[model samples]
Target: MKRLLNAIRDQFELTHNEAKSALLFFVIILVNLLLYYSYSAYTVNEQSEILIEDYGKTEIPESEERKSNWVDYGSSYKKSAKKVERFSFDPNVATNEQFERLGFPKYLAKTIINYRSKGGKFKYKEDLLKIYSMKPELYADIENLVSLPSKLDKKTPDFDEHRVIAEEKPAFAPKKTFTISKFDINTADTTQLMQIKGIGKVFASRIIKYRDILGGFHSIDQVGETYGLDPTVLPELKKYAVLNTKVKKIRINDLENFRHPYLRYNQVKVIVAYRKQHGNFRNTEDLKQIKILDEATISKIEPYLEF
Candidate 1:
């Protein structure tokens, strides 16, 4: 302490009180340093801003697209369904293999069937987004694989309201005889259903045996129940179908009895679903299994029962 005091008083030429002032200045500098460090630490402890947007509407630059190169990094590249000549993607009709071909996980394929069975249809691209916990990236992957068209009601579209109208032949037309030469709706195979105009391979097959449990359609409107037939096509289907077409429901005891080879899958599914619910097909309503069922279908299948 004496050495410091002598150095301060001699070398610096400071008064006794001046040295004390110098000491006070050093202490203030130390306190300022500490306060600075503490304030910096506190301020740094809370520093952030939240962000909440992924890839929605960002302008992904045309120049970036132009500069993109074709690098072969994947084992194979998948094409969009729209790019392909023919790709099957009937959610109700796609097999597990077909589902995988469309790039959906196999585990979720059955869930998709359940979705369809519950009256869901892949009507729009957005519908796939509604799947449970479906990933956005996955939707981006398969967005192109989905195909949907507007639909009309089979009841209104395919019903032949003009059947009687056409029957009212004039005196000259009274001599004009009409002969039937088309496949019967009640017994036609998938191939046979195709003879009808506007019915494609997919729609034809679905119409014949979609709910094979119900036998044939009791009403022409039942045609609308076929896959891909939404309310939009009702006017079209109505032109070609007759509401009084002979059709029947499966017997309660013989839920397993569809003799048509084309209807095998539908028949078996109906039996299984029937047994699952009521153990027997006492009524057409027993067919709520295999997929979705509705009052409209039940009414259609109710007319031609033997049991």
Candidate 2:
């Protein structure tokens, strides 16, 4: 090939050494061009075949996809942290949508938003407990979801037509003024005691402590044994205080769906309690053995219950 190139160079009127050197350069250039053409053809073929191979590889379904930072396997990484820091809500300015976003029940969200629209602000944190149709315990579960305005957002909320409807709703019963003696000392739970006109957690706890220390409260005055038990509270306390020695201890089992006061016909909580205290029931009739439960309550709940 070199000799042929040398002769061709000579025929073109080039010197032997010059023709040889020129032929060598031409050979190098030709080899480079061949390589470039090969690479270009390979690249084109690769691109065309990419679709046939599913864009170079098969895609994973979203469920099987590698998740982004916020998502993993299924849920958001931030959401997985059970103890969520609650969002702040300006009650006066909060919308029903905002309340729902905070996980308030639909009725509660509407009531809270409507309450604020009527020139109302939660003067105290506990004032939130007074919303109609809201249970004290349910309110507590959602309480952490409440977020007040920052110092910059501290302006009071204006009252609107929504407020009128909320005001009309009587969330609380007429505060039954009662002495501790009027409430069956044994029967009152924290909830029933709180319903008494003037009672709060501190006073209620004191009454229970007093009952425990004395083995049982024989009289309403014995409640005075509690530290910080205001002597003047007695005038109000006497109305609610009922001294009954026959106290029943109701144990809470699975907390998911027990102790709901509205569920007066709950056979499940009673059955669960019975099973815990006595043992697996020998028969269905044994359900009536619970003093607080009756045949009607059992009949209403029998379908959902088990041993």
RMSD each, Å? 43.4, 42.6
For model 2, what is the alpha-carbon lDDT of residue 184? 81
What value does the lDDT take at residue 145 in candidate 1? Answer: 61
Q: Kindly report which residue stretches of model 2 are placed more than 4 angstroms away from their true locations once superposed.
A: 1-182, 246-307
The alpha-carbon deviation from the true structure for residue 306 of candidate 2, after best TM-score superposition, in angstroms, is 42
- What's the residue-level lDDT of 67 in candidate 2? 46
Name the regions of candidate 1 deviating beyond 4 angstroms.
1-183, 189-197, 211-213, 243-245, 253-301
> lDDT tens digits, residues 1-307, model 2?
7778646543553445666778888899999999999999999999889776876656666653444433231233223234333676656677777765655555667778777778768744456767876556555655655564233344655354125444566578788864434558655777766666445676677667656644455567756666654466676667766766642222333333443221454555665767778876655487778877777766644433434
For residue 128, give model 2's deviation from the true position in Å.
49
Q: Residue by residue across 1-307, what tens digits does model 1's lDDT show?
A: 6677646544444556676777678789999999999998876664421122333455555665556853332212233232323363655567767775665554466678788889887765666777774557656665556564323323444233234334654565456554435444666666655545456666666676664645566656667766554344556555554544455544546544444322355655665556766665555545554354455544444465555
